[model samples]
Target: MNGKLLEGKVALVTGSGRGVGRGIALDLAAAGARVVVNDIGASTTGEGADLGPAQQVVEEIRAAGGHAVADTHSVADWDEAHAMVQTAIDAFGRIDIVINNAGILRDTIFHKMTREEFEAVINVNLNGPFYVSRAAAPHFKAQNGGNYVHITSSSGLIGNFGQANYAAAKLGVAALSKSIAMDMQRFNVRSNAVAPWAWTRMVNTIPAETEEQKKRVEGLMKLIPERIAPFVTALSSDAAAGVTGQIFGVRNNEIYLFSQSRPIRTAHTSDGWTPESVIERVFPMFENDFYPLHRSGDVFTWDPV
Candidate 1:
């Protein structure tokens, strides 16, 4: 509730021209971070560019006495994405945080999904984070401290029908964050992800035209906006530095920290095994100790057996 939680910090947020990205950019600014707002000004389908959204967010931050600047960079390109981080350094002289929130949806069933559709989703949702985070990693290392939060989605964590392209790309983002966290632990650069279930323009792609689909949409309408921001803000804070390589479903006024566990193993297998024996004994462990597809927090635990 106190402003200035991020006082003196400089944050770069990608895809911050509108929707959830815009919300995060403004919130970070209000918390006293000088923000670089990056957006390609692209549409939901990742088409076209208009500088209005990024500029508007900057003005809003300025009007509210928060420091911010606009950046019109496509996240898919390494050069432009690097420039985005450079803008933060140029203005504030250092980078302390990054929110990889830029994304686009190119939904299609696997059968009907074209290579173009798949690549577009992967390039924006997955590769975009890759480019920005790659550029920011060094700066974070030099400073010896920083936070990185990637905006993932429920569709990726829990599979969605007709979202093969989007889901794969989002899951890739999660995987990328995990690797970054593992490598950056010694440098104090924490990395994590947030799986948001908010109502945004991205959700418009969900097929809610049918009555059944509409009911599902109405059910989700109960989730509030305030509930989503806290978890994301926490992930981008000093308090969450100890927590990395995780994912959280932030909605419904509560934060659920996701965890993954390897399936139990009864024995080491030989090279040649019988299918029946494997199915009866080995597969049972998978039923009980399966890792969560989406996870968060410290999974390494020591408990008395």
Candidate 2:
């Protein structure tokens, strides 16, 4: 409440009815941004919709003397996603920040995953951001400046069991954010993605089959949504103006700058070679550079700080 970092800014945050999105919406409002809280209020698996969740967040923001409006629009729909941007423009006269945070999970091992399962997650998590960000691009360009904060996931950055669709969608988002940053840099529009590690309803779907698993989940539970809000708010504000096209991670007290993909090793031959020759020489040359098939847990083994 003390820091009016986003004073006079108009922000639109999708899936702001609950969890990490809700925390981000609240923090932006508290920083003096008039907010358009967009949430379809669907179940974790992307089924059914209600207005209760979005409306509740709007009420809470208003009670705190912040400006906010509820928008029960599905981010997956192109028309509805554009309408969300319009809602902010109609209410606040202009939009300055767009946070693509809407998402759902349809967890299953890759082999067992259905086409429907894959498409459902992709539509909401990946396509949803694409629609909303595309809709807002013109406005951002017109304004001469804007900010985009996308909610990506570590599941995609690393890998995770039973989340092939979710991971693919999230990784797509990070790539999309980077592309947006590059294309919109001339327009003064900054885009970045955050892979948040928070305990939310989607995370609860993971089964704790062993004592160690239970303990780990318990540790994750302590990394509440609130802990990630500050960094998100900072990224959305002018305070992070110099930063863009970067991937970040938030877990409890820890904030990570994730390394982007780049060539670790390369091999060259003086003459054109057959597949067999290349396999014998080039493959062995980069053996140490090859990454292990690590799952998300293998990378983030420690508890949140």
Candidate 3:
């Protein structure tokens, strides 16, 4: 690959102060995109804010001879989100790529989860992407070209024990991206998502010594730190044009595409359709392989082993 594959393009990454977000932001910069590094500087649990993370990322990019600007805007309010995009517009004169990697974890079982906890995660993980994407929507439409990648999680994809709020927010983000992709098609704006399992501060919280925990962590580590960025980078590239409304699980040097296609069958009886009949007719759809695997196409498949 050419060193300047992204030359003249502009990429913006949110929650890029640390971990997967930070890695993605740097990679974009390295590939020759003028980058906008955004971070609210909140803790892993979404508490207070700090400006250091954003500034630090900017410095790293600069030191590596890449172009970058730092934005401390929280992706909470609409205005802040708008300003965040504006920062990129004012700097590079055009917005080409967006990686919505900013997120927070408020892990609690549904029964014990508080409204505040729920709202906080929703605001940042789900609404934050909404704010940024909405702000960029018009600009993307005007440019006639753009790319979007939202960071999601397996916890949300498959559900986790203590992450009801986080899971809900992540799933909401995936749904939101799919919807936006349809609107962006006319404008050449492609929106997709990445569900990453990395040993970041969030995953590090799970104990690694226990057999169960070790197995889980090891399975995730298969998609190492650097592997995740390639998925985002590919999505951000012109090569991935028209590739929208998709979700990828990235880790351990592998990328797995996920989908939700069920054997949707409608039943027809001789003018007598009861609820019982409806249930009985649909029972067979529950059989294995009735639902085709989602996004299991050649361009986006990986062997779990």
Candidate 4:
């Protein structure tokens, strides 16, 4: 129990071939979980797949005297997602933890964003998690316990430029996580979302043409992807049994519990509000509380510790 937080547990980590996913897979394996290192080895834009990355991570785990298996399957497809989960069960008898970390980017400003760009990001980032989690739902129900940790983004939680597609999908994931937690509570299945700030391959895509963008990139570089693994692994363990339906963030050594959407300011009139009245009364009342167009970087201005 001292060294093995997940002893006897079997975990599946999507996109485990590279970057943040790779770090998470390694950590989960080190924690005594037999891992299914699933990755299509897709590039940042979700094009092309290679088997090398997944296999290499599996080999690394084995070299460390840990158990892991490689699986190359696209999480975007419903059938393929199920196959990935089945790989875990086939190899380890049962799967106890799932980390939905596979994602793609097609960043473009709203005015210039194309349908293909939008759909592509949505399919992988949003639909992929749903497919994988849905596939695992029955098994979790049968076993009476399982954990899900989805890799979300602050782009959605806060806001970002040139990432409408990504933000939408990530925000949707947060909602999905919460809904899953509520629905599966009786079955002892838990779900949560984590927005990780790290200099991963995904973050590498951010252009640093301007000084501001360069600064953001520099700050991102300070956020080590591996730093996200500890919190995620702990959350996946039975030790976090009472923790579910939460949104968290990990940046460098900083772990944050983010606030969810709740009614902060409310206003009502004795009579039904007309559009004109609402504009006159409600607008001013909520004006101070209205969130500004601050990007994730803007909000986290301080250097990572």
The lDDT for every candidate, in the order shown, is 0.80, 0.92, 0.82, 0.94
TM-score of 4: 0.98
Number of clashing residue pairs in every model?
Answer: 4, 0, 6, 0
Q: Model 2 Cα displacement at 304 (Å)? A: 1.1
Find the 10 residues in a row with the least total lDDT in model 3. Answer: 292-301
Best by TM-score: 4
User: What is the C-alpha lDDT profile of model 1 across 128-231, one tens digit per residue?
Assistant: 99999999989989878989998887677766677888888888888888999999999988889888766677776667789968866665555454456556
Better of 1 and 4 by TM-score: 4
lDDT of 3 by residue, 1-305 (tens): 63577888998899888888888888888888999999988888877889998999999999999999999998988899999999999998989998998888877778998999999999999999999999998989987989999998777777666788888899899899999998778888899989886767777665567886677666545545555786788778887776899998876665678975454555466879787766777566555435343321222234344
lDDT of 2 by residue, 1-305 (tens): 43589999999999999999999999999999999999989999999989999999999999999999999888888998989999998998999999999999999888999999999999999999999999999999997999999999989999887899999999999999999999999999999999999899888888899997798688778878878889999999888899999999998899999999998887877888889988899889988888898887789888778
By the TM-score metric, which is better: model 3 or model 4? 4
- Give candidate 2's TM-score: 0.97
lDDT (0-100) at residue 248 of candidate 2? 98
Whole-model lDDT, model 2: 0.92
TM-score for each prediction?
Answer: 0.88, 0.97, 0.88, 0.98
Instruction: RMSD for all candidates, in order, please.
Output: 5.7, 1.2, 4.0, 0.8
lDDT for 176 in candidate 4 is: 98
lDDT per residue as tens, model 4, 232-251: 99999989999999999998
Which residue runs does candidate 4 get wrong by more than 4 Å?
Answer: none
- For this target, which candidate reaches the highest lDDT against the unseen true structure? 4
- lDDT, residue 84, candidate 3: 94
The candidate 2 region of ten consecutive residues with least summed lDDT is 1-10
